[model samples]
Target chain A: MDFATLLQILDSALRLATPLLLACLAGLFSERAGIFDIGLEGKMLAAAFFSAAYAYITGSVWLGLAAGCIASMVLAGIHGLASITFRGNQLISGVAINFLAAGLTVLIAQNWFEQGGRTPALEGAARFQNITLPFSETLAPVPVIGPIYSQVISGHSALVYIALLAVPATWYILFRTRFGLRLRAVGENPAAVDTSGVSVTGLRFAAVLICGFLCGLAGAYLATGLSANFVKDMSAGRGFIALAALIFAKWRPWHALGACFLFGLLEAFGNRFQNLSVLGVDVPVQLMQALPYVLTVVILAGFVGKAIPPRAGGAPYVKER
Target chain B: MPKWVDVALIPLINLALALAVSMLVILWIGESPFEALAIMVKGAVGSAYGWGYTLYYTTNFIFTGLAVAVAFHARLFNIGGEGQAALGGLGVALVCLAVPWPHWTLALPAAIVGGALFGAAWAAIPAWLQARRGSHIVITTIMFNFIAQALLVYLLVGPLKASGMSPETAPFPDGAALPTAHDIAPWLGFRPSAPLNISFLLALVACAGVWLLIWRTRLGYEIRAFGHSEPAAVYAGIHPTWIIMATMLISGALAGCMAINSVMGEAERLVINSVQGAGFVGIAVALMGRSHPVGVLLAALLFGMLYQGGAELEFEMPAISREMIIVIQALVILFTGALDNMVRMPIEKFYDARRLARQRNGRGTGVAAE
Candidate 1:
């Protein structure tokens, strides 16, 4: 491929990677805090619908972002209430949340807009616009790095930058703070954390809510940044892919970024090339889309080293008293 | 609490809560909740037509529910029902189209084996991963669901499409079509052409077989023992790998058998999205049914009614919409599966209190008599 084509592909990869990156980081926090969240897909779906609807009504992308986050947070709260306070099975609760979001988003959209469960398209300031980084115009004359810097890196929507920024921020929060220490402690052994006078329930809830916020951002980016309107089941299986990425990353923040980007690059490649030929045999694009999931299965199956989950993940913490 | 209460009352209460929440949602939409409920009930059971659709859906659910329940018996979450059911459809298509059979009687048995085998084969990889490699079945199964969908799309668009505009295989030979409710129930004076077919009977047979396998067989005892306490089962010399593989194989086979209803019975050809979320719905059904064959049947019927009735609501109300039905179903799952203890613990406490009072009364009377 030409250098321009390569740059275009890389550009598309970054855009596609943004939502997955945010979501992978979101899962990192939840899983590290001992909460297994399969409902990431659902939360993102709900946020996408809500953000689009609100942005169309209020004519402000910022308001749309807020609405999306709040909607995601509500679902997250329900997940916490069920799995934590009620001490229900975490996996079952997550599955129910997914069902709830999938249904509720479309139902509410159908009722309010009456356009077959889709929100009105946002325009102008209601949608996220691509940003041109500083010195991009002057740097155009530079040889190898000019197009890479301007075309590939500079012209992404604001959310892409935020998602990229979140990786380092998440790493800092997870590894360099007292709260992070307590959170890791809770995941590995809640009993020890509880004996240390830290509230395991509290730490876990915080982690889950933080996950909700990040998922909200991911969803908002999908609806308002990637596209101008919300489509039914538009998140598709990205949430699940993010989960796969989280597992592939071994629940680390920086590793999550790398995993999500790799998956995103595959998706971009699939989008660019509908079919590819390998050694004179035709390979369909579906196979390309399925590659990440196949790799995740392989990783989990210990073809590589085993990917261990947090010790106390998927179980509610109950005091021995 | 008694076992019966645990089995019956808890699910019933949860179902009531889910319906009540659904009613409130209808009210929020500025519709009469009572009228909506009335419409749903009348639509689902008022006519043979409604019953036909409901039963057709019920048949699909029974297969998938039994698939999940059998796996649950061995403490395995076979979430690959979606993938398995999809592959089952492929199996049915291959068998029905391989040769024009003179009779469905012969085609049916071959289709059953094909569907079961394909479903089991799809699940085998994940089962092996879990049994030997300690990979989580839930993740692998979910990933497989996406892979299965992609596979179906690729085949239908390329190899399976029958010189038509749509991405679906050609209709099977007439003889391969299973007898619908209109055909079989004529002697019983039942009319109204619904998709309901002889597969309903097959579903019931599967249920009975599952009940026998789970309760009457030694394998059932081993599965239950393994589920309840894995360490104890291992100490007792049960092989974990063997149990996991065996349970998942049965689960996948049952899930695959669902294609008999949708592919061979209703559609008479393989079509994309023929499974239509029934695999996921089976999770809720198995949960509400407490993983018992009888319970699965009952739960399947309830969901079948919801689905049929939900379609009716869409036609009548227009405001309630189809997605609302999904919300209602989600509420049911949330209450019955996740928040089950919200109702169970209170009832348990009530029963404990009653037992204590009865014991005190008996002891006091004995002292007085002495």
Candidate 2:
């Protein structure tokens, strides 16, 4: 109700929204290219563990970021290999990747650190320290805009800025570029794209790789930026939530950002307020925590306009030739 | 080349591939793969006690696997088995705790009906959304899993806790407990005190019932027809809405039956996190089994071995932790389900080539004799 409280809630919402935003964009690329990637959670989990492990070993956050991306890319490549090259079921491949990541991350972490499937706590250069924006001190003396600039906009990890910037970048690539056109065409109808003399597989593989890159950044931020270490199943269900957000947005990049913020705000409120009462009634905490999922279901069920997926999504393409 | 190949050889080959990869992982972990395999075998089936535990786990997997397989028959992915099973536990707890039954026999049926109804009710929303509103079943079912967990947490912490600090209910009444495997172990010349219970018999009966329903009944025909081709089934006058709703209700009921084993037989209380990833494990089981009742039984037993063996592996070789078993399970699922065509296509091609050579040779001999 108060301004400061509202500002604090918004700040938490932004922080929570960053990972969801990155992952939504990741799914955007994969789905736009006709690949349904339910394994985003698994990819993020793998990236989180590898990033934290490498970061702890090298004491360099940059190296950790690289390792995280590579780890995710490897998984994305495996998914591509299974679903595309082998012409396997995409959902099954995604499920396998989730199980594989859940098991291997903990197994390897135990072998290396012996800390019950967790990486060592990161600090200093090993972690993504918050960046206070320029003129924060000068801005603090200003009126309402001062706190808005310093408190709400500034003091976020660098990855937060990257995630915010990725929205427009994704929009530009998806709607403005030649590759984007090909990607969209491939998802809608691979046969049309193939006849156009563009290799359908190549475009899809490219999109999946970009998905891997963005998911990696999201996972890295969760480990090295938001939290200090990797824990078992730390990605939890964020990947699925991102998928929900993606569907809620109807595959648009800008709408995906809005959806992520909405879900993030729900999560923030759930965390802050254990219980709420409206008028003379009581509202349960479980219902509050479930609001995002409930809303996504309602939206999908045509309470909002129908959320149509890519036409060729989840099907492996095969050329008759 | 034959029906047997698809039914038997393919699964065996996939199992071999998964185990081979697991062996490599073990080697990488600085343990002898042979030793790990030996220990796992001994741990899972070597003793009466081990068999007891294996069968107990097998019971849980079988119920969940059948749940998944039933929905799969109608081309519906019911990923909410975890949630359904959780709610089923709530149902069983409510019935068992609400009234002091005169006997275990009377209480068993009540619990089963209660569990099935609750689980089916949980699944109905997702099924309706998928059938009527065009929402994706996979997404809704998955979301339901999270909501189910949160709901269970709230109940256990608030209304269900029985005057204790722990987030679990008190034990059920004396008459509510199912007969454990220990009661039967003596007559079978086995050791007593294993957790295997009467629910295992129920699982066997359910398997038989599923087999009959799938192979002998008209409804099963409609379900399979719909799964094979939705347009064809629709043209044949089968309503998609009815098929979807009916199939999911059956699936949810089977999933809820798992509570009979974990809640009534083993724990005898409503506990948090009781499902313990068994619902997802059922997906792997159904996949490996190829959705056949007999195959599901076999796959469930194998997973049961992996689970019990994995526990043993941790005790025998600390380097190979329990999570390693999950890695193995994932590999099996990956090979059997996702990469099924990878091995199948090559084998089919090999058989085709061999048959072609035989035919040509026969023709060449006839020409020479003429």
Candidate 3:
């Protein structure tokens, strides 16, 4: 392929990867603390709806993003209450949260927008503009790698930069900090953390809330940066894909970034190959669309190395006196 | 203080909470909450047509519930029921369309068996993957659901598409179509107008069969014992891995039966998205029923009623979105989970109290006897 075409594909892939990357980081934080956050999809959907609506109304992308994060946090708080306080099954509670968010968002969207199941499209001021790194114009004269560097490496929504930066930030907070030690302790053995004078509940709740914030930002990136409008179920299994990435990466922040990008690349290519049918030689679009999910299953099923989760993951710990 | 009151309290509490939440949503949408609820009640159970629809919906749930419950009994979570059911439908549909069986008697059995085999094969992959690799079934099954959807869409829109039809297969041949209520009414002495079919009977029979399989047989005993404690069961000479795999195969087969009810019984053709949330709904049914055959049957009916009612609310009250059904399902799951948690706590507390009481009483008796 030509350099320009390759650059275009790479840039598009990066934009597409942005949402999954953010969601992977979000899932990383929660799972690291032993909370299985399967409701990431619901949080992302709710955030995307609210952000798209707010952006369309006020024409301020920042306001829209803030609203998205707040809305997602509220849902996350409810999940915390249900699973943590009530000691409900973490998986079931997460599924319920997803169902609730999906239904509620569509219900409100239909009522308010009367657009069936989509928010109003945002204008220029309400959407993020692509960034051009300094001296890219001077470097544009070079052949081949120049376009790849300028277009794919440099130009992207601001959230793309944030998602890339979050890998190290997440790693540091999860491994190097005191909070990280306590979080790990809670996941491994809540009793030990409790005996060590750390409130297991408080730390886990904080982890879930941080998960909510990151998922909200991820949703905002999807609606505002990737697409100007939010459609029903627009997260479109990306959150679940992120969860898979988290597992595939063994719940490590930096590794998850790479996994998310890999999955995202597969998705981007799948979308691109939709209309490339040759005479009497063709691959169905549905099969291509199914690639990421199939890959997830294959990877988890030992096409890759063994994946080990946190010891106490998905268990609700209650101290025995 | 009454025995019946205590026994009935949890379901009642759950129903009340579900109603209240639904009513609040209806009110927020500027609809008459009471009227909407009445419509739901009437639509689900009050009339013959409503009953037929409820029963029809329940048939699918019952099959899928059994699918999930079977795996739960073996302590294996089978979340791939959706994919299994879809594959089952595809199998049945393909058999019905392609098989050249001249007799209805031959075609029907062949199609059903074909569906079961396909579903069993599909589920075996995940079971094998989990058994061999220690991979989590939840993630594998969830991924498989997407793959199944994509495959179904592709087949419907491509190779399997009927001539001159749009992304849908041709209706099954007369010999292949499931005998509906009208078709069988003459022999059974029932009204010809009902929508209910023989699938309900098949579902109930399947439920009974499942109960017998899990309660009476040697295999059932081993499966249940394994569910209670895998290590203990293994020590007792039961192969846990083989049993788990067996449970998944049975579950997937039952899920295949669910797809048959929709494809052969109702639609008379396989359509993309025909499973339509039934697989996920099966999870809630299995959970609410606590994985018992009888309980699953009853819970499936309850969910069927709610689903029918939710649809009725949309037609009678346009102000409320049909999405309320999803919200109600969510509420049911929430309340069911809460009730399960509540029941466990008090039971454990009671056991603790009884143990302590026995210890003190034993000490006093020993002193007196001495």
Candidate 4:
């Protein structure tokens, strides 16, 4: 492939990786606090639909993004109420939220848009544009890897940069902050944290709400950054993929960032292979589509050495008398 | 009140809560909530034909529910029922079309056995991975669902494509089709056109078989013991790992039965999308049934009513969105999971009060005698 094309592919890979990165990081926070947040997909889906709908109505992408975050936070609040406050089973509550989001999004979309799904196509102003990094254009004429650096590293939506920024930020917050220590303590042993006068429920609820905000951004990125409009089920197992990444990363933010990129690269390569009919060894489109999921299984089975989830990951915490 | 009455009250409260949530959703869509609910009820159990269709759908759910419940009994979640059922349907379809069996008795059993084996094999991969590699079953099963969908799509469109047709297999031979009671519909006083068949009877038999296996057999004891406390089971020399694998195989076999409904009983052909979402719905059914065989059967029938009723709502009440059914299902699960815990305290208090009253009465009688 030409250098320009290679650069284009890399750029596309990074852009595609943004949503998974953000969502995986979001999951990292909640799960690190010992809550299994399977509802990430549902939160993202709900946010994406609402964002696109708001964008379609007000012609303001900013408002749409804000609305998306608010919608996701609301979902997170409900999850927190059920699983954290009421001490319900985290897995079941997460599943319920997923079902609720899946059904509610479709119902409301059908009601308002009058289409089974899908809002109107968005205009350029309503979508985020690529940022041209300084000196990149002039540097593009140099060598074989120049175009790769220029295209892949230079022009992209703001979310890509933000996602990259989140890795270190999450690390700093998780390992270097008092709040992070408290969150971890709550997850590992709520009673101990309670004895120390730290409110376990409050900390976990905050962690979940933070997850909601991040997931909302991830959803907005999908709808407004990656595509012009939202499609039904468009979040489409990405949440699960993010969860896999969290496990594969062993619940560490920087590791999860790497895992998300790897998954994103597999997806991008799968798409590339679909277009190539190599010497009568053409792969079926469906198989190409299934490649990432297969790779996820293989990696988790073989390479994810040992997953040590939070000590209290799915256990409901109740105060001991 | 009676103990059975107390037991019944929880589910009823859950149902009522779910209904109230669904009504709010219906009202949000600018439809009369009462009218929409009326349509759902009328469509589900209002007529004999409706009952038949409900049973037909329930057959698949019962099989899948049993699959999930059996796995839950071993403390293993078999989320791969989606993939297993797909693989099962593929097995049945391939055998029905490719194998030559002159007798119906032989062909039918062969098809079912083929399906069960395929389903079992599909589930065994995840089970093996989990047992050996420390991989979580939930992630593995979710990944397997995507793989199965891709494999089915590839097979349907490529090698198994019925000549000159769409992406589906050819129809099964007469020997393979499950004998339906539709021909005897007139004598049975039911609609002649209903799609109800012998699969419903097979499902009921399977339910009874599962109940017997779970309650009456040594293996069932091992499975339940493992579920209740894995460490204790291991201490008791039950080999919890092997039991888990065996439970997955049994669950897969039950899911395979669901394939018979689609491949041999209903469609008589392998549609690539035939598995639908029944496998996931089975999880909800198992949970609502509290992982009991009889409870799974009842829960499956209730879901079947929802499915049949949802379709009718679309036809009868044009203004009501058919997707309301999914909303209601979500609410049911929410209530089932939440209300289950919510009722525990109250029920315990009631029983404690009854015990205290009996103790007071006994003391008074003793004192009077003295």
Scored by DockQ, the top model is 1
Q: What is the C-alpha RMSD of each candidate to the true structure, in Å?
A: 2.2, 2.5, 3.5, 3.1
Interface RMSD of 1: 0.8
What are the per-residue Cα lDDT tens digits for candidate 2 across A245-266?
Answer: 9999999999999999998898
CAPRI-style quality class for the chain A–B interface of candidate 1: high
Model 1 C-alpha lDDT per residue in residues B1-370, reported as the tens digit of each score: 6777888878899999999998999999989999988899899998888888989999999999999999889988888899999999999899999999899999999999999999998889999999999999999999999999999999999988999899999999998989889888776545645899999999999999999998999888889999999999999999999999989998999999999999999988898988999999999999998999999999999999999999999999998889887898889889998898889889988887777776688854433332
lDDT of each: 0.91, 0.91, 0.82, 0.82
* Shift of residue A21 alpha carbon in model 1, Å: 1.0
Clashing pairs in 4: none
TM-scores for the candidates: 0.98, 0.97, 0.92, 0.93
Best by lDDT: 1
Clashing residue pairs in candidate 1, if any?
A: none
Per-residue lDDT of model 4, residues B14-109, tens digit only:
778888988988887888888877887899899887887888889889989999999888878777788889999998888889875576577778
Q: Mark the regions of model 2 whose C-alpha exceeds 4 Å error after superposition.
A: B187-192, B359-370
Error of 2 at B300 (Å): 0.2
Candidates in descending DockQ order: 1, 2, 3, 4
Q: On a 0 to 1 TM-score scale, where does candidate 1 land against the true structure?
A: 0.98
DockQ of 2: 0.75
lDDT tens readout by residue for model 4, A1-321: 775666666777788789999999999889888788888999999899888889879888888888999999998987887777767667667777777888788778878887766777889768777788888888888786567667788888887898899999999998999999998887788889999888888899999999999999999999988999888888988887788778778899888888888878767766676655658777677776676677667766776466767898877788878
